[model samples]
Each structure stands twice: as C-alpha cells, then as structure tokens.
Target: MKRTGKRIISMLLCVLLASALSTTALAAEDGKVLKLAFTDSPTLVIGDMTIYHPSYAAMLAFKGAFEKSTGGEYSVELYPNGVLGDAASTMEQMLTGTITGSTPADGALSAFAPDIQVFTIPYLFDNPTIAYDVLDGDFGRQLFEKIAAETGFRVVASYDNGGYRNFTNSKREIRTAADMEGLNIRVQDSPVYLEMVEALGASATPVAFLELYSALQTGVVDGQENSCVTTLGASLDEVQPYCTLDGHLLGLAFLVISDTWYQGLDADTQAKVDEAGREATIAARGICRYAEALAVDTMVANGVQVYSPTAEELETF
Candidate 1:
C-alpha cells in the first residue's frame, strides 16, 4: 500500500514539473521574438578558435543590446547562411512582417530601390571614410526614408560589406585588365556586376552565391571578385590561389526592420532598437579596420598569392 502511494505521488510531481515547463515555454513564445535574416556576405572578421564574420558579429551586438535594453522581453533570432531563404525571399518576408528584419546586400536591395545602383559604380568612393560620409549623411537618410515609404522594410542602420572588392582566381596573376581577358569570372546576379566584369575583359558568368563555391571548385568559372572578408568567409580562399587588390566596388549592407513590426513595438522599444542598430554599425566598422589586415595576412599564410597593383596598372583594365 505504501509503495502504491509513493508511486502516485511521484506521478503527480512529474505532471506538475511538465506543466511548469510548458507554461514557461508558452510565455517565452508570447514574448517579442524577432527573426533577423542575413546571408554569409563578408564583413570584418573576428576569430581565434573560430571566426565570426562581420555581419554575424554586428547581428550579435545588436541582439545583445536589444535584449538587454528591453529587459530580455525582446529576443532576436538570427537566420544566417540563407537558412530562412534567399535574399529576395527574405526581403519579401520582411515587407510582409513574416520576418522581422534582414541585412541583404545593397546590390540585391537595388532591385527594390533603384537609387542604390549609383553606389555600385566601380571605384565610386576613393576611400572608406568617403563611403562612410556618403552612407551616413543626408543621402543615406533620404534613401532609407524613401525605401521605407515604398517597400515596408525600414533601414535601421547601414554598414560596410567588407572593404573595396578585389579580384581572385585559380588561373593566373591579375596585374592588369589584360590579365583578366577571357577569364570566365563569376559575377553577382546583377546588371552592375555583369557590366563591370565585361568592361574588365572577362566573360561574365552569372551565378547564385549559394552555388558559387561548387561552381568555382568544379571549374565552372576560373575567377571571382569580392572583399577579403567575403572570400575568407565563403572559404573561396582555399580554392583560389591568387588575389589582386583591385579596390573595385565599395560594398554596403543595410540592416532593415519591417515597418509593421516596428510600429507594433512601444516607443521605448523602438528607440532601443534604433540605438542598437547604430551601435552595431560602429562596432562593425572598428572590427573591419583590424580585420582587413588580418584577413590578407591569413590568406597569404594559407598559400594564396596576394598582389596589390598600382592605380595606373588597375586603370588598364
């Protein structure tokens, strides 16, 4: 009889514990949990044992700030590596408030906001400071407001997507445009990139970023170009043997939140979100200065031949 009673009490305790756990889970679900998406686009890298790409680092900083400022009532869940979906799909989700946020490439965003194309012009900014000035000035503010009015994705912050893009290949050293001739180079799925590749004397091949690594590995393309952080993050450095610091396009990434979602948040929460975004931008830039130096050193250490051509040499392309 005592054994039976003890067993019954044990069952009751188990049921109570399960109920408590379920209630806690439900409460957490009821809280504001935001889904922020970004791809593996390169940025300033932070790694010792493991690398945290710039975008992920910015996301982490934003998440930590936002959650702390909001007393842990708000949480950010990152969807990196295109797990939530491709750039366009995730941007659509942000508009509909299906996903709360995303920081897609400015090239990808240009399709929705045509004004962004101007920034993609080759060698537009002479240096990173000028790029920062333009992006953080009235021009950037006006464009963000216009985009929010048009697309429902409101820009909270903008950060450099690594430094100026450089050329990389498995085939040959690229000191001039003549070296780029006939090279089957993989370009982003955008007209600006296609035009740039063509102008450089290479046969431009459009490829989805997700498929780029395999394409390069399988001899689908002979070369590609992007910032150093991007090359390392994508592990393209392992397959590509030569890197030329061409200093082409000045890349940008926009941290955008859904208008509908932002509107739903309380004024204080909204302010906190904006503050966190700015903090992330600052943090990312600081990391980039150090990261660029380290990234090049690491690639060289890994046996990738690094070359920096003179401005006159680059103009030949």
Candidate 2:
C-alpha cells in the first residue's frame, strides 16, 4: 500500500510540473518583445523634414508607454536602417512573425493591395492638408482596415514623404511633356511608376536608391523623379543641375505591425503603441517639410537653378 501511494504521489507531481512548464511556455509566447525593422534610417528626408524613417523610433515610445500602461508586462525591440533587408522583405518578416513591425509607403503596399494604387495616381492630391484629410479621415481608415483584412498588417500611423517632382542633368529645362521625349530617367521598380514615367514620354530605368549616385555619375540615366528633400538629401542635385517642381504625386508612409503580434498585446498596451506612432509621425512629417524647404533654399543658394512648371504645362501628364 505504501509503495502504491508513493507511486501515485510521484505521478501527480509529474503532472503538476508538466502543467507549470506549459504555462510558462504560453506566457513567454504571449509577451515576447516585439521586433521591428525598417529600410530607412532616422535622418532620411521625404519632404520638408527628416522623419524618424524607421518604425523603431515610434515603437520605442510605444514600448515605454505600453510597459507603464501594462505595469511592466510587455516590451519591444527595434532594428532600424535596413537591418532586415528592404522594406518589402521586412514586411514579409513581419507577416511570418520573424519581425513584428515595419514602415512602408503606399508604393510599397501596392504589391499586396492594388487598390492602394489609387493614392499613387499622379497629381491626385493638390496639397498636404487635403491628402491628410483624405487618409486620416474616413477613407484612409477604411482602406487601412480593408488592407488589414486582406493582408495581416495593421496601420498605426500615417506620414507624408513628399510631393513627387523631377530633376534632370540636361541644360534644356523640362517645361512640358514634350521636353521629356527620349530622356532616360530613373524610377522605382513599380508598374504604376513605369506608367507615370511612360506618360511623361521618358524611358524609365528602375534603379535602387543606393545605386542611383553611380548610375548618374556614369550617365546611366539623364535624371530621375523624386521629391525636393530626396533630390538634395541624396545629393542628386550635384549631378543633376535642373529641378522641375511639377508636384506630380505625393507620398505617404504607414507604420504597420503584424496583426498576430498586435493581437497578442493587451488592449491598453496596444492603445499606447498607436498613440506613440501618431506622435512620432507628427515629428517626422515636421522634419521632412522643414528639410525639403531647407534643401531647396540651400541648393538654390549653391547655384542650382529651380523652376516650377507653368500652369498650362502641368496638365500634359
């Protein structure tokens, strides 16, 4: 009887230990640090200012606030400056739960959600305010929810990159669509971008951002289309002398986190993350706008002539 009782106690102890281990594992999975990655660094400028280009900066603020809100139960890890490859790759990682978050623009999201292309349509937005009203208001929020339903990413913040324009190395200014005939220009590898460039009557060469300088130096392409901030930030102004202020399209970036990872976070903590994202977005937009104006002023001061497209000349594209 004593031996049988001892054996039964041992079995009970084993069951209890197994249950404890399972609980621990469940807790670990439930509250692991959220890992975030981004393609751009903090100093990247899109429009008039330098946005904290990575989602990490915003995530950091969220982490602290979330931990406080949750009584120190949750945390986050940030990997900025393309540590996990390009934005698209990082986004893939987010979906797979390898990384938890990323910041991607409308152009980047177009791959998974083609409806996003509507925002990419050239000259669709007249000014920043209208763009913000559309995106931050009912339509943009609805699009975000739709995209989240289709792709498992959630949007927490919205930011402006810039108003897309053009710059060229040639002495002849691009006043109308006719001026772009046969001119070789660089663009990002997107079908929509190709369409826009083709509409402008220029041969579009898709090139990565890092390789653009060499391409311009070797005369691989005559010029490229980008915002004022990017043109000067990347030092494209040195190789390309003329800048056309066409304001062809505006760019907006979203701070997105994996839906699975986000769902794991408690409600209060999630709210904190969303709030921090908005705060960082405001800071980034301010920096980009300021940087764009500064870049234009600085470049013009340095003998780079800048011109705006005439009213009639703007409608060709």
Candidate 3:
C-alpha cells in the first residue's frame, strides 16, 4: 500500500508540473508577442548626426501603433543592434517562425528571393520619390504577393533605408570609377553588390554589415559603399575619413513577416498589423531622408572629407 501510494504521488506531481508548464505556455501565446529584429544602433546622433536611428524609432512606432490599434491585445518586442543576429540570420529565424518579423535591407532579401537583386542594380531608382511611388503602388503589391508565394514571407512595409549609397574609405576620396581601381572594397553579401563593386574597378570583398567597422579598421577592405545615414549611424566616419557622394544605389528596407504566422491572425488583427507597418514605414522614411539631407554637413563637421563629383566627373564612371 505504501509503494502504491508513493507511485500515485509521483504520478500526481508529474501531472501537476506538466499542467503548470502548459498553462505558462498558453498564457505566453495568448499575449500575442510580436518580435521584430534589426541590426542598427538605437541612437544615431553621437556628434553631428542628430536623429534617432530609424531602425529603432520605426520599430517603436510599429510597437506603439500595433498595441494601440489592438487595444493592448498584442505586445511587440524589438531587438536592435543585431541582438537577434544579423539580417540574414534574423530573416532565417523569421522564416522558421522563430521570430515574428524583421526589417532587412534589399540586398539581404536577394538571398531568399533572387528577383530582389534587380533592385540592387546600381542607380535603379533615380530618386527617393520615384522609389516610393513604385514601391507603394500596385507593382509593389504584386511583387510582395509573388515573394510571399515563393518564400513564405510577406513584405508588410517598404521604406527608404538611407536614401542613396556612396563610397567611403580611409585611403582616399573616390571621384570617378578610375579612382575605385585597385582598392579592395567591402560589399554586402549579395552577388549584385559584388558585381557592381567589381564593375566599378574595385576588388569586391563580401562582408556582413555588422562586421563592416572592424573590417574597415583592420584594412580588410580599403572602402565600402553605403548611404550617408548608414555611414554616420554606424560611425564609419571614425574608421573611414573620406566619402564620395556617388549615389550608386538607392537603399531600401523591407519589413517582412512570416506569411504563415500572418495568415494565422484573424482579419481584424491582420488589418491592425498592416496599419502598424504603414506607420512604421513612414517613420523610417522621414528619419532616413532627414539624415541624408544632413549627412554631408554632419560628416564634414565630424572631420570626414565629403566630396560630390561634377556631372562630367560622375559621367566618367
């Protein structure tokens, strides 16, 4: 009788522990956590760059808008500064439902959707306005649908990443394509970037965006191309003192969520998520444009040489 009682007690304790764990899990799921990850510092203004980095601000906007629209039924948790990992990894996590969403650069998306590489072609969009119009129009919706069908990811929103990409280096200022020759340049882990850099007469070195600073400081690459906002936000000016406003590529970012997860949400929640994403997109674009406008002056004030090529000189490329 004693042994039987002991066995019964053990079974009861196991059942209770299982019930407790199940209840905890259920509570967490009921909270409807939306985890968004990105790889940029929360603060952009350190010296002359006086604006909150859009990545952080926009995520906050998304969180606030979603919670407000949902009447606090959902909670958003943001992981900035690559806390969740770099773009590629975070995107993978999102794909597997390990993360709810992520804002990855266009180049990063190319890995999963090869068609996205077309956007990375140098000078695809002449200006931000054109880019915005195209992205926010029917074409953009169709493209998103195609991507969803192909990758199980839905692009919830699109926004300017930094306006335009330019070359920055510690070696010297680049004035023409000739100037790029013989210099090893760090390019994003995308073939289009590699081809673009090489076509510009530089040796293209593929590097993760998170490790760019160390790569530049250690002379792994002589230069890198990025938007002024990214250059300043990452403090690349500290490592690279020269910048040429070549504007080779129009930078863009996409806020993507797992289509599977999104489909699971009810219609009301889905609409709320879309609304929040739109708000976040606007916030990101505003800050990016503001930063781009001030970036040249800011970088110059911060002891980095900023140069704009003459039309004739620009044509030399």
lDDT of each: 0.81, 0.74, 0.84
Q: Give the TM-score of candidate 2.
A: 0.78
Which numbered prediction scores highest in lDDT against the true structure?
3
TM-score of 3: 0.79
lDDT of 1 by residue, 1-317 (tens): 99999999999999999976675466468857788897764333423424555677778889889978976667688888888888899899877768888887787787788877778888788778888898789998888878888877788877777677889999999999889988999998778889988988899999888898999999999988888877987899878999998888878877888887877788987899889988888877766656777778888988999999887896675
TM-score of each: 0.78, 0.78, 0.79
Q: Whole-model lDDT, candidate 1?
A: 0.81
* Clashing residue pair totals per candidate (backbone < 3 A): 0, 11, 0
Query: Candidate 2 overall Cα lDDT vs. reference?
Result: 0.74
Off by over 4 Å in 3: 1-31, 46-50, 170-173, 178-184, 203-222, 233-235, 238-241
Better of 1 and 3 by lDDT: 3
lDDT, candidate 3, 151-245, per-residue tens: 98888778877679998988888898899989999987777788988888899999898999999999999999888877887889999989998
Residue 83 in candidate 3, Cα distance off native in Å = 3.6
Worst window of 10 by summed lDDT in candidate 3? 46-55
